[model samples]
Target chain A: MTNANPHRLFRGGAAPAALPARGGIGLKPEHYQYILDTRPAIGFFEVHAENYMVAGGPFHHYLERIRADTPLSIHGVGLSIGGDGPLDEAHLDRLAVLLARYRPESFSEHLAWSSHGGAFFNDLLPAPYNAGTLARVCAHIDRVQERLGRSMLLENPATYVEFEASTMAETDFISEVVGRTGCGLLLDVNNLYVSCINHHRDARAYLRALPLAAVGEIHLAGHAREVDAAGAPMLIDSHDAPVAREVWDLYAYAISLTGPQPTLIERDNDIPEFPVLAAEARQAEIVMARHAKLEAAA
Target chain B: MSAAFARALLQPDAPCPAGLKTWNGSDPAKRFAVYRNNVVVSLVDALADSFPVVQALVGEEFFRALAAEFARANPPRSPVLAWYGDGFADFVENFPPAAGLPYLADVARLEWLRVEAWHAADAKPLPLAEMAARLADEAALPALRLALHPSLRLLRSAHPVVSLWAAHQAEDVSAALGATDFADAEAALVVRDGLDVDILRIEPGAAEFVESLLRGAALGEAAQTAAPFDLPATLGLLLRSGTIIEATPSGRIS
Candidate 1:
C-alpha cells in the first residue's frame, strides 16, 4: 500500500540508513579506499558537506559506494548560520543538492559565522550572544531549514575571545536557538572543553546546563595547547591528534547525561591510518556501552 | 562588528575588532590573535594544498607569505575552497615579492587550470566508433559541431611551464628545474578521463585547434586554424583521451 504521508517517505523511506547511537568516524578522502575495502563495523560515517559539493569525481564515486553500506551524516562548515550578512542562497542551493543526493541520516552546522559580506573566512568565527545577534541567527536557521526541508543540528563554537556585548550566556544562547528554531544541537565535547579552558568556564556546568534532550549527535576531536600572554593554557581546536583525555572524560559525562548519542571522531589534519581512527571510534563505543550498562542497572 | 572582526582577522596590521573581552577582563588582543592566526594560516595552507607545485617552486616560507598577502587582499568569495584561488595567478603576476620569478605567475595559472579541470562536470564520452560513423560522410563534416568534455582545458605560456611543472613533480626537483629550458614556450592539454587528470604537453597549434573546437567550430574550420600542426596525431590524442562528448551534424544525416 502507498504511504499516505509523503513526508514520512521522504524522511525515512528514502534515507539509506539510520545513524545508530554508537560511534562513527569522519570520512576523509585519504581513507576512502580503506573504508570501502574493509567496511568496518561502525554506527555511521560523517563528511563535511562542502567537500562533496562537486558535480562528479572520485569524491562522489567513493561516497556513493560507502553510503550504500553505511548511514551518512552531512556536517556543514560553510553555512555560516550565525553570520551577520544574509545567507548565501547559492551556497544553500548547493548544499540542498548534496542533501537530496545523499539523503543523509543527519545534517549539522556550527553556530559560529564563517563568512562576512561576500568573503568566506574558512574558519568558524565567534558571535555575540545578544538579542540582535540572536534574532539574526534564528532567521538564518529558519531560512536554512525551510530551504532544505530538514531539521539541522547547530554546534556550539569554541571561542578564543568572548564579546563584551553578549548579554546572554553561551548555554542560554544555544537553548534559545533550540527553543525558537526547533533544531537539534551537535554537542562537540572537545569544543566545549576547548572553549571552557580558553574562557575559564566550567565544562561540567556547561554540559549540565545545555538542553541535553535536544542533542541528536556528539563530536570528539583533539586540540592543541598554547599559553596566552599571562601564561594561561589556551586550547586550540586543532583536530590533528587523538582525543584529549579531558575531552574524553567530558564525553563520558555527556553520554551519561544524554545516554549515547551518535558520536563522531573528527581528525582533519595529521590523518593517521584507518586502524588508528577505528580504534578511537571503538573507544567512544566502549564509553557509550559502559553508560548503557549503568542506565540499564539503574 | 562582524565586518570589523573579519577585516582585522584578514589583515595582520589591522587593529583588533571592538567588543572583545577575555575571561580575566584583560585586553583580548592575545586571545583575538589566535583566531586571526588560525584564519590566515588555514587559508595559506589551503592555497598550498591547491598549488603544491607552486609551493615547491617558491619554497614554503615565500609561498606562505605570498598566500597571506593574497588572502588579505582577496579572500575567498565562496565556501567551496576548491574554487578558491581563482585570482591567485593574477595576484602572483603583479606581486612585487615574486618579481624575480616571471614564470611563477604562469606556473600558478597552469596549476589553477589543473584545479578547475579536476572539479569540472563529468561527461560521458561518445563512443569513438559512433563518432567515426557519424563523421564518415565528408559532405556533412564541415557542418558537424564537436563538443569537448567539460573538463578539457588548454593552456599556453611563453615560458616552459609544462616542463617546469613536470620537474617539480620529480623526486630531485632542483636537478629537474636546473635541466629545464625556461625559454621554450609550451602548451598543455588538461583533461580528466576515467579516474585521473592527464596533463599532456601539446604543440601551440594543437592548443589553438582545441581552443577552436571548444568555441564550437567545425572540424574543417578548426583544422584550418591549426595549419602546419600534426592533425592526425592531435585527433588520435583527443580520441584516445576520450574527450569528445558529442558530435551533432548541422544538416540531416541519411
Candidate 2:
C-alpha cells in the first residue's frame, strides 16, 4: 500500500501556512518540476488564482505537494474589481471554493477591470480615479472579502493613460479605497515607478501619498520601454525581464516605510529557469535585510 | 468608459476612447495602443498556449495571424482560459485560408478534448477485482450501470485524428503525417489515466459503446449498441486505464 496511514496528513493540528515576510516568486507551470526536485528555500510562492481554477490536473497535484512545504499567496488577475458592473458571483463562488481548499496566507486582486458587457478582455485595463469609481471599487472589495471571509490585498495598477474625467490622483484614489474598504495594500513597487515615470510625477512623493502603513505585501517586476507619440518615454509593466534597478530601489524605499514585507518577483513572460528567478527573489531579500539593518541602527 | 474601452480593446483600428489622455500632451492614441496591444496579445497568447499543436501544424507566423483574427471575432467570455478556444474547430472549418486541410477542424476538436480531459475532476477507479466480480454476474448485467471517469471524453472524425495527434509526438511530423490517410474515420477516447491524460484511438464501433456508457446506458443495452465489439478487449482497456470509476446494479432492494 502506498499509504500505511493516509489519514496522518490531515490531523488538523498543523498551523496554516502564512505569507512569510521575505521574498517570493510567481509559480509558473514550467518551474513546477524544478521547484519540487530542488526544494529551493523560497520564502513563499504566489500563483495566479485564475490558472488553478480547474477541476484537476498536474497543477493541483504539484501544488498540493509544494504547498504543503512552503507558504503561498493567491493573486487573482481577473476579478474586474474596478468595473462599474456587478461582481461576477459565479467567479466569486469559485474563489470561495479555492480559498477554502488552499487557505493561502495572502489573497490579492488588482485595482483594474478586465471584463465588461459579457466580454472579457483578459488584460488588466485601467479605470478612472473618481468618486464613482472609488465607491464601486470599494464595494467590489467588500463583496470579495465578504464572500471569501477574509480581507484581501489590493494591488495598484501600472497604467499608460490617465482619464480626463478623473477628479482624484491615483494615490489618493487607492488611499480612499483602502480606508473605506479596510483592505491592505499590495504596494507593487514596479507599478509605482512605472506610473510615476509615465506620468512624470515624483516617485517618492507618490509613495509618500500612499497609505503606507496598510501595505501587506510588495510586488517587484520588470517593464518594457517604448516611446509615446509625443516623443516622451513610456514604460509598460511587462514582467518579461529581470526586476529593474529603479523598481528595486523603489522597493527598498517602500519597505523602509512599511518595514519588511512579503515581496514577490513577478516574471510572467520569457520566464527563465527556476534558479534564475529564485536568484532574483534572493536579491529582494538582500535589499530588505540591508534596509532592515539600517532601521535597527537608526 | 468600459463599453468604449472594451469595444476599442478588441478593435485595434478603433479610435482611442474620448476621455483617455497621457500625462504629457503626447497623443493618447499612442498610449492607448499599450492597452490594445495587451488585450490582443494576451488573448492570442492564451489561444496559442491552448492550441500549440494547431500552431505547429500551421507555422508560427501563420498561426499568430490566424489566432489574432479569431481573437478579434470571438474573445474569451470567461476568465479561465483553459477552455478558451472551445469553438476553434467550428471557426477553422469555415476559415477560407485553411481550405486545403479539411481534417484540421477534427484535429482541433481532438486537441480541445485533450484540454478538457486535463482539467476534468479527479475520481477513484473501481478496483479491477471488484469489476471482475461484477462482470461475472450475467443475470445482473442487464441492470448494471457503470460510472465512467469524469475526464472521459469521445471525439469521432472522418480523418485519422488519433494518428495525426500521435504523429506530432514523432520527431518527423511530415513523415508521420504521410503514413496516415484521411479516408478512414477514427474515434478518439480521452481519459485521465492518472494525473496525466491519455488519448487512445478506440476501435471501430467502440466509440458508440463508450458513448452509451457515458450516457448512463445499462451494461446489456450499451453492449448491444456497438455491433461486433470485442468485450474482453474493450473492457480490458477501459478497466486497466482506470476509466470506470463505479459499477452498481439496479433492482436490488438489499
Candidate 3:
C-alpha cells in the first residue's frame, strides 16, 4: 500500500507535518458541529480508534469534515497490547486499516492490559512489571509497529493495585519498553497524578524517572477523589470533570522537562460544551508557549 | 497469570489472585477491589447505553444490579462494547430477578436490533427507475429476487414490545404506559436510512414476508408464504423505506 501522504513519514527516516507541539481536545460527537462551525483555534483533535471502526456512517462523515481543518491523533483502547495471550490479529488489522485510511499524525495505546483468555474487559487492568511481562509487552509492541509500518506511542496506565511479583518500577518498565521497541511515550500527567496518589508514591519523583526524551505527547484530564478502605485519599482517573489544579501543576513541570509536545485535554464523561474543553486546551497551549519562549531565549 | 488476574477482577467475590500487593505492602484485596469495581461498572454502563429502554423500565438501581450480574456471569469476549450485549436478551429471558416481567427480554431484543442496525453496513438503494422497468416486465416479476439492505432486521415477539419501545421514546410515557396491552403479539421492522435507525411496527404476516425474502425466496414464493398479509402494502413499505438494495431475476442473478 502506498503512503497517502508521500511527504509524511510516521516511523522511519525524517518526519514532516508532525502534530505540532500545541494543545488539542479529544473529539466528541456532541461537539462535532460546534467545532466545525466555530472552527476553534486548537492544535489538533484526538479520537478513540475503535469508535470509527464501522464501514460507513455519521462518525466517518463528521471525521472526514473535521480532519480536513485540523490534525488528528488516533488513541486506541482495545489493542490489549499488554495482555499475556497473543495479540489479537483481527484487532491489529482493524487498527492498521484505520491508521492507513486516516494517516493520523500520531497513534497511541495504553500500557495496561484489558483483555485475556479471549475476554475483553472494558477497563484497563494492571499488569505485573516483571521480566516475563516486560518481554511479552515488548514483543507485542514490536508486532504492532511492524504490522502498521509505523512507530506508535504507549501511554502509562493509571492503576489502583500493585503486584507482589513486580520486579521493577512502572517508570523503569516503560523506559525499557521504549528502549527495546523504539516506540515513543505519550505521558498522561493526570494518570501519573492519580497513580501516584493512589500508590502513595512521589509524583514529582515519578516524573523525573520517566525517559523524557521519548515523550512525544502529553495528556491532561480530570480525576475523581474517593476514599480507600484505609480512609486514605484515592484518585480515580475519571475524565468526567475539568482538569484538577494539582494535575495542572504536574503538567507544567512535565512541559519544562520535555519542552513542548502535542498535548490533549480528554473529557470523555459528563462532557460540557465545546468552549469548556477549549479553555482547558488553551491552558495547555499557554504552558507549552512559556516553555518554548524560555528555550528560545536560552 | 494475566488470565487468572482477569478472572479474579471480573468476579467480585473471588479472592485476589496470588502474588498481588498494595503499595503500602498490605494485602491487595481492597485496592484490587477498586479495579474490580471499575471493570464491572464500566461493562454495566456499556449495557445500559445499548439498552436504555430496558434500564428505564427496570429503574436505575434494579438495572445496575441486573447489569452487574450479567457482567459477572458473561463478561464481554471482545473489546468492542457496541457488540458486547449480544446475549443479554437471552440472559434476561432466563434471569429469575426479571421473571416477573416477561416483556423485558423482548424489549432488550428490540434495543439490540436497533444497535445492530445503527452500525450496519451502508448500501445504495436500487433506483426507482430501474425498479419500475423491472416491474413493467411482468413475465419475470414473480421470479425476481430482492436483496434487502444490510441494516434491515425483522423481530417478532409474543408481547407488545413494539408499543413498549415506542412509548419509552415519547416525551411523556404515562399514557403509553397505561395503554399497553401485554398480551398482544407484535412485530417490528428496523432499518437504517442515512444516519437514522427507524423502528416501525408491522403485521405478523408482513414480518414473515420480509423474513422469507431475507432467506432468498423469490417474490412470488415470499408473497405466497406470507399468505394473508397485504403483499402490495408490504412491498410498498420496503420500497419507500429503501430497504430493497437490488432486484434481479432469480436465475439470472445469484
Candidate 4:
C-alpha cells in the first residue's frame, strides 16, 4: 500500500527511506511542550510543511503526539515548484492532503521561483536555468511527482541574483532535475553559505559539484549580512540568527560530503529556547559523531 | 539587462529598462537594485506577518507604509505567505492611507481571523461525557453534527475591535491609551486553544449561537438560536472558550 506513483514507484530502484544519519531540530511553536517533555536525544523532527497546513486543534494534536515519538520530515516551504504559473491546483490539492497525512519520511521544496503571472513573490525568486528554463523545470518536477504521489526533496536556492539567461549549472540544474524527475535533493548548508557569499562562488566548489547520490535531506540554517545595492557585504539566507561559525564550517563540510544525512537545526527568526534549539541539535550531534569517527577509521 | 529584461523588472505591465550601467558586476541599475530591494523587502515582511493586528493598529511606520502600498496594489497570489493576506481585510477597506482608521477594517478582520484560526483543519473532540450522553438521547439528538476547531475563529465588530485588540497588547501603550473606549462594539472567537491565541468575547446571543453552529445548524437548532444568550451560558462559553474544539456525533464526520 505504499506505491505513490513516481512512474510506478520510481521504477524499482526506490531509495528514500535512509534519514537518521542523526542530528535534527526545527520543530518550533517554541518547542511544542518542550518536545513533549524532554524526549530529546535529537535525531528526528522537521516540520514546516507550511507549519502544519492546519485543520484542527493543538496543531494536529501536537503533531500527532510528535508523530508517536520521532522520524518525521515534511519541510516544504510552499510548493511554488518554480512557478511561471500552472501547477497549483489548490497547491496540489493541499499537497495531496499532506502526503496522505504525514507518511512523511521525506518531502521537500524550493528550486526558487516564488510565482509570476499568477503573482506570489513571497521571496526565493532566482530561476532561469535555460533550455527554456530547463524544460520548464522538468515540466514542474514531473507535475510535482505526479501530484504528490510522492518523490520530492528539491531545495538548492540562495541566489541574490543571477540570470543573463543562465545556461544550466547550479550543479547542472540539480543534475537535470534528478535526471528528469526521480526528484530528491534538499542540500541547503546555510544555502551553501549564502550561495557562496552571494555568488563570488566556491562554497568548496559548490560542495564539489553537488548531486551527492541524489542526497535526500540536509539543511543547516542562519544567514544575514545584507548591503547589496552596491554597498558590498551581501549574504542574506536569513533563517534569522545562530548557526554561523562559518555556517558551522559549511555544515562540517556538508557532513563530510553527504554521508551521514538527516541534519536540520534551522532557527526561523530569533527563536531560542527548547534548550536553545537543543543546543543547536547538540552541534549537529557533534558533527554526526565526528563523521562516525571518520567513517570508523577508514 | 535581458534575463527577459531582468525578468521584465518584476512585471506590472513590464517595460522599464532605460536605466542601469553596471550592477553586482556594477550598474545594470546596480544589479537590478539589489534584486529589486530583496523583492520589496521579502514581500514587505510577508505583509508584515500577515497583518499583526494590522501591524498593531498601524504603527510600525504606518504599517511599513501600508505594506509598501498594499504590496504595489496586491502582489501575492499564493506562494503561501500564510495564504498571503486574504485580500488584506479588503485592502484596508479601500486604503486611502487607511482612511483614518474606521477601526482599521475591523482590525484587518481580526487579523484575518487569526490567519484563519491558524490554518484550520484538524478535529476529533467529541468527549464532553460523550457530548453529554448524546444530548440525553433524542435518538442520539437528531444524528448530531458538530466539528469545530480548525483554529475556530468567528469575529464580529462595529468598532472597539476587542478594545482595539486589547489596546495593542499593553506592555505600555501610552499607559494603555488613557483608559480605553474609543467606541465599544465587538464580538469574537479566535481559537487555537492549546498554544495561545484564545480571545473569546461573543455573547450577543453568543454570536447568533456560534453562527448557528457555523451554519450547519442543529444542536437543537443551535440551542434554539442560543435563546437570547444563556443557553447554559452559551454552552458553557463554548466549552470553556476554546470555542468547542471537537464534537462529532453523526457517525464521526471525518
Candidate 5:
C-alpha cells in the first residue's frame, strides 16, 4: 500500500468553544427565513461544505449571514476516506479554503469511501475493515487533518452490505482509526439503528461497542422502511422523515453513554416547516438538559 | 457467490465469494442492490437538478436515459453531488441522442452556469452610496477595476438561447421559445440576485462588455472591449443587474 508508513504528526489547531454541546438542525433552504427570524435556541448549525464550496453567490451570502449569528459546522461528504486510491489533493485544498473562510467551530466527514478509481458515488459506500484498508483510511485522515489544519469528526457509515474480506468489526475499525490517527467520531445514532437493523445486529449493542470516549458529536435523522422479497422490512437512513422512535431511544441511550455530545437533526428531503424541525431540535435539547440535570444532581 | 453478486455487491470484476451471506434471512445482494441503485439514481437526480431545462426540453424518460448514460461515463468527481454536472454541457454536446437538439446542449450550458452562479462565493454588494460617490471622481473611476459577484456568469451561444430558456419558465410568451435555430446565436448574462438565479438575454455587444471585466480587464480596457457596441448602456445594464460586486484601484485612474 502507498500509505503504509504512518507519520504520526498532526499540526492542526484547537477547536473553537463556540460549538456548544447542544442540539442543532441541518440548515436547509426551506427553513432559512424561519431560522433568521426565530433564532431557535439550538447549539450550532452544520452544512454540507460542498453546498457552500463556491467562489461567490447567494448561498455564500446567506451562509455568511447565518454564520454571523450561529456557530457553524462544515460537514464534508466528498473526502472518500476509505478508498484504495491516493488522497484527492485538489478537493482537500478546496475544503481548506472553506475552512479558512468559515472558521467553522467544528468539521466532520463520513468514514466511507464514496469514490473509487475516480468515479465518485454520491452516497456513502462501504469499505472492508482489514488492516490494509485501516492503514489507508488512517493515512487519509492524517492527510486531511494536516491539510485543513484541524481535527475532524469521522462519521460511521450506514451500510447495507459488508464484504467477506472484513477482518474486524465496524466499531473496532472506527476505534482503530481513532487510536492510530487521533481523529474524533461523529456517531450518527440513526445510522446505528439503520445499519444494525439492516445487518441484523442490535443497535444498543453496537453503541456499547463504540469508543464513546472519542465521540465528539452525534447525529439523529429520519429513516424509511422497505420490505424486501422475503417480506422482511429493512430500515433505510433516508434523512427525509422525522427521527424514528427507536432511533430517539437509541439517542437517549447514546447520551447516557457518550455524555451529551453536540447533536444535529438532519433532514435532507421532504423537509417540513421550520417550527416542526425546531421542535425536533428541542427534543434533543430536552435530552441534553435532562442529562445535564441528572449529572448535576449526582 | 455468483459473478452477479460480486459485480452487484463489490466493484466490477472484484473476486466473488462462494456463499450466500445472510444474518437475518435476507440476501446481502438483495440489500446491496438497493444501495447501488440509489447511488446511481441519486447522482443522476443531481445532474437533473443541475440541468432542469435540459431535462424539460428532452422530457423525463429521455433525460433519465441520457442521465444514466452520462452517469456511466462521467460519474461524479466530488461527494458534493451539486457540483457533479460541471462537465454535463460538453457531454450533452457530444451525446448521440441529443445531437438532434443542438440548442439543447447550450441550454444545459446556461443552466449549469445558473448553478455555478447560485453557489458562487458570497461577497458584499458594494454599497450604492459608495459606488455613486466613487463614480463622481473620473480619475478614481476609470482606474477602478470592478469585481464581479461570484454568482455573475456570462455565456455566449450562436443560437437564440435566452428565449429558449425563458419559454421553459411560466411567464414568458415569446414565440421563438424552445425551437430557435442554431443560426440565431445569442449571448446571455446569468447572475444571482439575492438567492435567485436571474438569466437575461444581452444584445450582440453587451455580453462582450461584461466579459471584458470578467476576464480581468480594468474599467478602461473593458470599456474598450465594449466599444464596438455602445459602452455606456452596457455598463449601466451590468450595474443595474448587480453584476459588478467590488473594484480594485488601478493607481493610473487617479
Candidate 6:
C-alpha cells in the first residue's frame, strides 16, 4: 500500500463541524430536490462516496448546496479495504478528489471487501479473520487513513456466511485492526444483530466484545429475514424497510455502552419520502435521548 | 478465497468458494446465494439506472434479463456504477434476442451518452448576450470558433434515437406511438441547460458541422465541409440551448 499523494484533501475554508451526536439519514438522489426545497433539520447526511466519484452532475449540484449547511459523512462502499490484493490507488485518488471538493466532516469504509481480481463486486464481501488476513486489512486501513490524511471509521460488515479459515473471532479481528491502524469504529447495530442471529451468537455478547471506546459513529438500518437451506434463519442487511424493533433495542443498548454517538439511519433501497425517513431519524434521537436521561440521572 | 469468491459471484452455476462456513452446518450455497444476488441484482439495477430508455424499450423483465447477462459478462471494472454499461450498446447489437430491434443498439448508445452528459464536468455556458455580442461582427463570423459546454455530447444514428427516448419520458406511451415510423436517420445534442439536462434532435448535416467545430474547425471550414447545411439554424440552436461556453475569433484561441 502506497500513499501516492500524501496530502490533505481539503480545498480550503474553515473545517466543517464533526458529525453531531444525534440522528442522520442516508442521502439519496430521489430525495435531493425534496431535501433542498424543504430543508429538513437532521443531524448529518451520509452518502456512498462511490456515487459521487464522477466529475460532476446533479449529485454534486445538490450535494454542494446541501453540504453547505449540513454535516456530511462520506462512506466509501468500493474501497475494498479488506481486499486480498492492494487497495485501488486510482479509486483512492478519486476518493481523495471527492473529499477535497466536499471536505466532509466524517469519512468511513466497511470492514469487508468489494472488489477482487480487478472486478468490483459492489457489495461488501466477507473474508476469513486470521492473523495473515488481519495484517493485510490493517495495512489497507493504514494506507486509506494516511493517504487521505485523516482518521476514518471502519464499519462492521453485515455478512451472510462465515469463513472456515478464520482463526480469530470477528470481534477480535476488528479490535486488532482498530488497535493497529488507529482508525475509528462505525458500529452498525443492524449488522451486529443480523450477523449474530445468522451465526447463532448472542448480540449482547458480541457488542460487549467490541472496543466501544473507539466508536466514532453508529449505523442503524433495516434487514430482511429469510431462512437459508435446511430452514435455518438467515438475514440479509437490506436497507429497504425501516429499522427492525430488535435492532432499535440493540441501538439503545449500544448507546448505553458508548453514550450518545452520531447515528445514521441508512435507507438505500425503497427509499421513501424524506419525511418518512426523517421520522425514523427522529426515532433514533428519541432512543438516544431516552438513554441520555438514564445516564444523566445515574 | 476472494479470487474464487468473485468468480463464483458472476458465474452463478459455479460451486461456492472453498472454506465458506455457516454456523448451522447447512449448505453454504444458500448463504453464498445472498452474495451472488447482491452482486448481480445491484449491478443490474445500476445499468437500469444508466439505461432506463433501453429498459423501457425492451420491457422490464426482458431488460433485466438482458442487463443481467450484460452485467455478468461486463461487470464494471470500476466501482463507480455511474460509468457502468460502457459496452452495453455493442453487446445489445450482438445479442441474438435483440435481433428483432436493430435500432436498440443506437438508442442504447444515445442513452449512454446521456449518462455521460449527466455526470460530465460542470462548466459555465456562454450567456446569450455574450454570444450575440461576439457574433455582432458579421464579417468575423467565418473565422469564429465556438467552445461547447463541458456536458455537450453529440450522437448520430440511422434510427430516430431522440424520438425513442422522448417517447419514454411521456406519462403514457401508446403502442402506436411506440411502433411509429421514427426510423429516420437522426442526430442529437445532449447538454445541460442550467442544471437540467436537455436532449434536442438535430439534422445530420448540422450534427456534422457541430462535430467539425468540436474538432476545433473554424465556423467557415466546418460549415463549408457540411455543405447544404443550415449554419444559422445550427448556431441559433446551440446558442439558445446554452451550449456555447465561449466564442473565440481567429487566432484568439491561441
- Give the number of the best model, judged by lDDT: 6
lDDT of 4 by residue, B1-254 (tens): 23453355455355435433322564345444555666667777777876776786667898887776677667777655666677777778888888887888878888788777766764444457766765677676655766676677777777767766776677887666566676777788777655556666776667876777777775766767533677677676666655565556665455
True contacts kept of each: 0.73, 0.84, 0.69, 0.43, 0.59, 0.88
By summed lDDT, which 10 consecutive residues of candidate 2 chain B come out lowest? Answer: B245-254
Which tens-of-lDDT digit does each residue in B1-254 have in candidate 2?
88998888888788988998877788898889988998889988988887778888888898888888999999888888787999988998889999998888898898899899899888899999999999998898888888899899999888898998898888999999899886878989899988788989987678888898777787778888545677779889999899999889974212
Model 6 misplaced regions, further than 4 Å: A1-17, B175-179, B252-254
Residue pairs with colliding backbones in model 6 are none
Per-residue lDDT of B223 in model 4 = 65
lDDT of 3 by residue, B1-254 (tens): 78778889877778988887666665567777778888888889899999999998999999999989999889888776778899999999999989999999999999999999888888988888888888888888789999999999989999998899999988889788789988899999999887888898989999988998898888988887634788888888888888988999876444
**Which candidate do you rate higher for DockQ, 3 or 6?**
6
Could you list the iRMS of every candidate? 1.1, 0.9, 1.6, 9.1, 3.5, 0.9
Report the error of model 3 at residue B119, Å.
0.6
Output the worst ten-in-a-row residue range by lDDT, candidate 6 chain A. Answer: A8-17
Report residue A275 deviation for candidate 6 (angstroms). 0.7
Q: Give the lowest summed-lDDT range of ten residues in model 2 chain A.
A: A7-16
* lDDT per residue as tens, model 2, A1-298: 1212232222221112257889999999899888889899999999999989999978898898999989999999989999989999989998888889998998999999999988788888899999899879977887887788777889999989999989999998887777666678898999989998899999999999988877888899999999899788899999999999888888888888878888999999999988889999999999889998998899
State which candidate, 2 or 3, has the greater DockQ: 2
Q: Which stretches of candidate 2 lie over 4 Å from their true place?
A: A1-18, B251-254
TM-score of each: 0.94, 0.94, 0.94, 0.35, 0.84, 0.96
Count clashing pairs, candidate 6. 0
Q: Mind giving the per-residue lDDT tens digits that candidate 1 earns over B169-253?
A: 7899889989999789999998989767878899999999899888778788888863468987998898889888888887322
Q: Which residue pairs in candidate 3 have backbone atoms (N, alpha carbon, C) closer than 3 angstroms, thus clashing?
A: none
For every candidate structure, what is the RMSD over all alpha carbons to the true structure, in angstroms?
A: 4.3, 7.1, 4.1, 20.1, 4.8, 3.8
Q: What lDDT score belongs to each candidate, Candidate 1 first?
A: 0.87, 0.86, 0.87, 0.71, 0.78, 0.87
CAPRI quality of model 5 = acceptable
TM-score of 4: 0.35
